[model samples]
Target: MEDAEIIRLVLAGHHEQYAGLVQRYQEPLILFLRRILNSEEDSFDCAQEAFLAAYRNLNRYSKEYPFRAWLYAIARNKALDLMRKRHREVLSIPDETMVDQRPNPEEVVLAKEETALLSEVLHELPEQYGQALYLRYRQELSYKEIAMVLQVPVSSVKTYIHRGKEKLRQILERREIRGGKGQPIMEEIISR
Candidate 1:
């Protein structure tokens, strides 16, 4: 069923139907929060709180906005609240170590290393830039949906993504130059 229809059912007092929404979004929501919070436990906690908040505020939900975007907005707020409490600024990428299902060990190792490098590079970016890039590329959220989640203008979202990609390219170039010499990317970034 469509999200709107499920929402209508939920609002019509079929509370058990709410589990479907949770199941559909649970993994994505947790992954999104994990990028921001950099802690699996915290992301899970924040996602749970966001869902509860969303349920309580379901009456305020409008059909005009996409349900995923709305849920992400709530999740973002919850993450921000947790950040304020913990005072953390560093963000990390999604964990990609689950390679047991893949066929080749060599490919899995290479992919894990690449993911680790990308995560390190992403951690060096400004929070907004990293988040905008993640939402656009990793989460596959549309520009408008990202704007809704970030509570920014769509133009700002576009600028962020463009600049983020440019910065990422530059970082990769620097890594390519210095990486062969055993210099850590963090040292390279810090020296600049």
Candidate 2:
């Protein structure tokens, strides 16, 4: 079912319909939170809080924006709040345990190596650029959706993404020259 129709049904007193939205977005939302929080438990908690907040504020949700973007904006706000309360910076890392379900052991090792390298490179970037790149490439959000989530203009989103990619490419190139065995993988990533 369409998100709009589900939302309409939910607002019209069929509160159970909200579960469908939750089911649809829960995993991706939690993954997004995890990247920001860097703690599995905290990410799950934040995801729940964000979902609750979204539900309560459903009436104020504008239809002009994509529902996924709106939900991500809520999630991002929740993550920022949690970080403020903790009074510390969160170091984002990809979960090592999360690997492709393919049975090949070699593929799993390559996946882990790639994830580690990407995370290390992202950490070196300015925080905002790292986040912009993550949202654009990792989450596959539209530029407009990323702008909404970041509370920035679409033009800013475009600039951030472009600059971020340029910076990432430079970092990868340096790694390729310094690292022998990882050169091919780094070059492939840079080519992408």
Candidate 3:
């Protein structure tokens, strides 16, 4: 059933209908929280909290936007709350399976080296840009959806994602030079 239909059913007193939505989004939401929180236990806890928050606030949901985007916003807020509360930084490598699963046969497979390089560069970026890029590419969310998740205007989302990609490209270019001289600079900045 479409999200709108399920939402209508849930709001109409068939609360059991909400389980389908939870089952559908929990895996992706947990993975997203894991990347942000870097702790498996915290991520799972936040995922549950996000779902509960969404359920409690479902009356405010609008079908004009995708339900997953709304769920993502709640999850993102939960992770940010934990970040502020815990004073933690450094994103652990996201699970190999965390990327979106929509089939696209022509997707280019990155070498292990390239994947590691990308992950490192992504983790190096400021949290805002990193999150915009992660939500865009990793979760395959649309620009509008990303705006919803980040609670920003669509233009800001565009600029953040554009700058994030440029920054990542610059980092990669620096690392591509001979003799591997980029390590010192990368380590210096990332160690903070």
Winner by lDDT: 1
TM-score result, candidate 1: 0.89
lDDT of 3 by residue, 38-110 (tens): 8889989999999999999999988888999999999988889888888877575465533537465333233
TM per candidate comes to 0.89, 0.91, 0.81
What C-alpha lDDT do the candidate models reach, one value each? 0.83, 0.82, 0.77
Clashes of 1: 0
Each candidate's clash count: 0, 0, 0
lDDT of 2 by residue, 63-138 (tens): 9998899999999999999899999778586664474687888877777877787778888888778888888767
Show pairs that collide, candidate 3: none
Better structure of 2 and 3 per lDDT: 2
Over all chains combined, what TM-score does candidate 2 have?
0.91
Which residue segments of model 3 deviate by more than 4 Å? Answer: 97-114, 177-192
Tens digit per residue, CA lDDT, model 1, 1-192: 999988899999998888999999999899999898888999999999999999999989998889999999999999998899888775898765562478878767766776677688888788899898888767889999999999999999988887887787678777674344333432333343
